[model samples]
Target: MEELICMDRSQRLFEDSRKVLVGGVNSPVRAMKPYPFFVERAEGCRLYDADGRSYIDYCLGYGPLILGHANPAVVDAVAAQLEKGTLYGAPTELEIDFARKIAKHVPSAEMVRFVNTGTEATMGAIRLARGVTGKNRFVKFEGAFHGAHDYVLVKAGSGATTQGVPNSAGIPADTTKNTILAPFNDEEAIERIVEEEDDLACIILEPIIGNIGCVMPKPGYLRFLRKITKEHEVLLIFDEVITGFRLGLGGAQGYYGVKPDITTLGKILGGGLPIGCIASTRDVMEHMAPVGEVYQAGTFNGNPLSMTAGLAAIGELERPGVYEALEKTGGYMRKGLRDISEDLGIDTRVYGVASMYQMYFTGEEVTDYQSALRADKELFLRYQQELLKKGVFLPPSQYECNFISTAHREEDIERTLVEMESALRTVL
Candidate 1:
């Protein structure tokens, strides 16, 4: 395995890096079996490794690069803003602009506060919910990731779920004891839990789950959730870090036509920069700091670089027909992959909504994490290696979603399909 030419350099890097970095990678999922390939550069939909091998990148930084790498607009915006300044503890107009832009694009958004990561956004939202409702307990779904925070880390101890005990060693049991867990698509579990736990302050979910592969809420599941949360005096929060601009200008809420009381956005919000935000109605948002009690602050909360990149990225996403193009591209990819698997007699199921899709290497419906776990991991591993060999790069983790950027054209799409056919043949 180490002798493989295409992956040898990556394997070497992992070995060298392990002495200094945990698992030889900054992030766990990036620690693939053959070691993660160290990217030298990326352009459009392609990534070039240190070994000088180019591959069509499907990981897209785990669903953030909806516009692809170094998009001229986003890059130029970040670069230009850097000349002005990097960070200032003081607030800037760019902050207001970005917030206004986000609120304008997302209907459910009336007021917004910026943070540095998705974890922070969710953390802030949870506190705000507790502050606003005067309740402590909350409801979270199984296998839905809300960043590496403590409270939302229940049943989610998947990627960073240290020991698969909901909360890691550092987090006391009391933190998650109130954090009730329910399976995705099981509204009954949620309703029953809400009925039992009258103190439940909020209910948060990914809407279209991406942590454990892309799983859409079944039928009126979201509507039912919204109803339950509202009826129970609980705030419904949508963790849209992945779904944000990737689904549409309004994210999953707009895509599904259901509104959550609060939405935490990350990934695409700052183009490729690290940023996250929590947006809610005026009444709900006012509960933070100056206006109320709950406090959330960051020195780089609205750094100029991220603000500019976000402005450009959101502008592009808000462009008319942008989502339509995404729908077409995502649909094409889903069909192409399904056809390839069927031709190779490989069992597979594609689940997701809008531009997001998940491919499970089993001929069964994957509605939740339990069902997704039934997939053929060995086949997925072989598929990953085969695709990499064919100059295509996908997220190594079977539990993550690979994205399709607008930069992908018919030609790029066709090449991916060709590689898929060849890779499927090799794996099967």
Candidate 2:
């Protein structure tokens, strides 16, 4: 590979940004050791950085850009919506259309309400669960991130997990007292907790824990959760913000064949724009706002730009053989990674479903957050930095999932594999 080009402009921008921006980044994960690369533009599977170097972006804007950056359809939709109005704070046919599509695609979405962000969606879902069940407490897995809200922030994942601060500092202890922690994929531990805790509102989790590097549920674990939550009359909320649309049209619920009482969606749902949704059965959804006392509202909810972009994005996803192609691409990359690891004599494991995967620099299976933490994070980080130098970008954090988008082509995968082999050689 050519010597990594100087990111002189990117470094200058970061230094300039630090004076105005918090920690030189709008989000924590974007703050790298020296500085994160500033992107000049992006389209399809590639990103052009400030220094004019291009890279294959596997982070995919933290799993939102499912069709990849600047997909023509999504861009056109947003452009057309811009010709209309941005926000009305009033209902439109666009909202109805998008909501209808969501209800049609997701099995649990009998009714749907829009929000501006995933944080609001999960917050609304939890509030509805509490109101409907007349209960105070809800259980969430240790490393499954719902959002930044107070209720689900305890033992949150993504940036929190990556930084080793699962529990945030500003949240009041009393406010989180009703928030319970459980182990992912451990039904027995959760069953015991559910049995013991009184006034339990719900059990919420990521069906496939993406924050701690895409840890999949043990076989039958989700089914067990469904059964037990139903038995106890506690609402089951699947925080599908990361998995929704990305896993498949029906998300993890459809993929796993286990339905939840409530579902929270975001990321790709807006087709790379900012949007979120909470879906549930009519009885449960009736508790929100004008119909019932439980209040949740957003001025930007169901805005035209997001609705249009989302419709276009989903339309592309619904194209025949899109998912099959995605699977093939992911499988191709996985095979290459495994081959490289074996050739380098590196202890590594790679596993994921559909277009998402994770690589842990350990031979053992990563079933939960604790086990995932045992992997060689330093080695993984070195590998990631090396890949970046080779004009390939993975997620900066070892704990985050590497996403594959519909725009990623055979050539992109092949080039990435070659780069991975070279990067791994240096790290291992």
Candidate 3:
């Protein structure tokens, strides 16, 4: 790998930013060692840093850029909407059209309400669950990040059945008291928790665990969850913020053939813009404000600009062979990574659904968070640095999933594989 030049401009910018902004970044993950690179602009699958270093961005704006950065259709749509207005603080025909599109694609999204972000979507879903069921307690899998809200901030204790410990500061103990934690892909543990816990409102999780290196659910695991949730009369909520439009227009529920009572979507739905939605059957959705007593409102929710972008994005996804192309591209990358690891005698597992992947430096099958932790962080860090120097960019953290966008061409994957092979050789 070639020696990389110093990000002098980015370093100076970070220094100046630290004087005003906390940790010199809005998001904590952006505070990388030696200062994270500041982006000057991004188009398609590439990102240009402040220091003029261009990287093949697999981060894809943390998985929202499914159609890739500055997609022409989406850009044009938003630009057109901008001429009309940005926000009305009221309803528009575009919102109705967007919601209908969501309902048409997502199996469980019979009715939909747009929100601003994934955090807001999950938080609102939780409130709806509690209100409808008249139950305070809810169940979430360990390592499954629904959002950064008080209820979801609790971490699993020593055991799966035990109450969660508050993982973040400023979160009240009482707020998370009803938040039960269980292991991902462990059907027995979830069943046990649901059976024992009284007045449980919902079982919420990402169908495919995206937080801990894209750990997939075991076969029949989601089906089991759906059955148990139904039998127990608990609302099953699939937090498809990452999987929603990416998995397919139908999301994970459509792919796995397990319909949840409610689904929260973000990421690809916004076409790289800020947006989110909580969808459910009319029976449950009727309970939310203007129709029922359960109150939920957002000033910027369903804003026109986001609505226009989302329409264009979903429209693009509706085109034939879009997902098929993603699968082919993702498979090419996955196979190349695995073959390289095998050739180098490295214990790496490249795993994920189509268009999303993560490589864990462990030979063992990663079924849950505990198993995922076995990945070698030190080796991953070194490999990541080497890959960056070779002009390939991955997510800074090993725990995060690497995304592939429609913008990634054949040559991009081939180039990435070459850099990855070199990076692995260095680490080994």
Candidate 4:
């Protein structure tokens, strides 16, 4: 049996934080049963907690740290930009440069609008779709989390699902009436909706559902959506916040060979900083702000610091073998986990693509929100806790995807697999 790690300092801090912060955490997923560990520092693929204990990190800051924590390239770029200035409330050449990089790499980015968070990106994208198409209704997959905004919050995943509150209380019925919910990978449902709802503006979804643990689309599923949406005069919006740069420079659109009318991006695009982007063809993006009827603005919309960090991060990603290495490591980790679980005779299903992955404690295939829900969540949490005891940390909930990074060495993968085997054996 693995010895339990001490978290006395984290427990004390959580107690103090609860007096001021909601649920002693900024996000619901960060809250664990016995108080989450407060990190003192992080570097490479490891996180050091307040008690000075380090663990091999698979959470990777909830899918943002593709290069891993405290990457030197990102740090140096942001440091230099700090000396120049953080924000100017005016346009900078850096914005143009970063936007050019995005346009060059992302399939849907002929034009771009920078935002402060994923919530803003998706919110703006949905509004732009509505304005351009002159339609109020839009379709979002049941477990696909676009953002926290009222428009796409119905049947949301991530923190909302983790907290058992997929539908928020504050959002009114009138607001959600336009937000139609459909199951991921269900072509019939989408076909019916598109044909029946002539006023539907767009269909927004995560090409691969990361919010509910790395559920991928069925074969030819994306192309089918692309074809149907076009025939129906409805737009298709790809929410690539978690998959953006992590999947590749072109992201899911490029990877899957399907182009979206609009794309919302965050996480890896910021290089570990706060950033979001709405990108699309010039014809589509022209509908936003100073040029078109749709209005969206943010003081921090093209912050030089975020632009600089993004440029540096993308530069590193463009290097030869970066993505290949990440893919290899991810595959290695997933195979290891699958093998370990099989050896322990545990009923589980591992799902992933590229550097993103998740293991659901269920015998059935996890393809959609309903199938994902059937997984043994309590058992998964017990495994996560056991892995923590052995210095391997995954996201605390089964609904959240774990990530790999360029910083994870072969040795780290091997050690993590060993610990995972022990944890699975103990938990099962």
Which stretches in model 1 have alpha-carbon errors above 4 Å?
1-8, 161-167
Residue-level lDDT of model 1, residues 59-118, one tens digit each, is 898888888999998888888888888988888999998998988888789999999999
For model 3, where is the 10-residue window of minimal lDDT?
157-166
What pairs collide in candidate 2?
none
> In model 2, where do residues sit more than 4 Å from their true spots?
1-7
Give the deviation of candidate 4 from the true structure as CA RMSD: 2.6
Per-model lDDT: 0.84, 0.90, 0.86, 0.92
> What TM-scores do the predictions have?
0.95, 0.97, 0.95, 0.98
Steric clashes per prediction: 1, 0, 0, 0
Question: Pick by lDDT: which candidate is best?
Answer: 4
The C-alpha RMSD in Å for every predicted model, in order, reads 2.3, 2.6, 3.8, 2.6
How big is the positional error of residue 370 in model 3, measured in Å on the Cα after superposition? 1.0
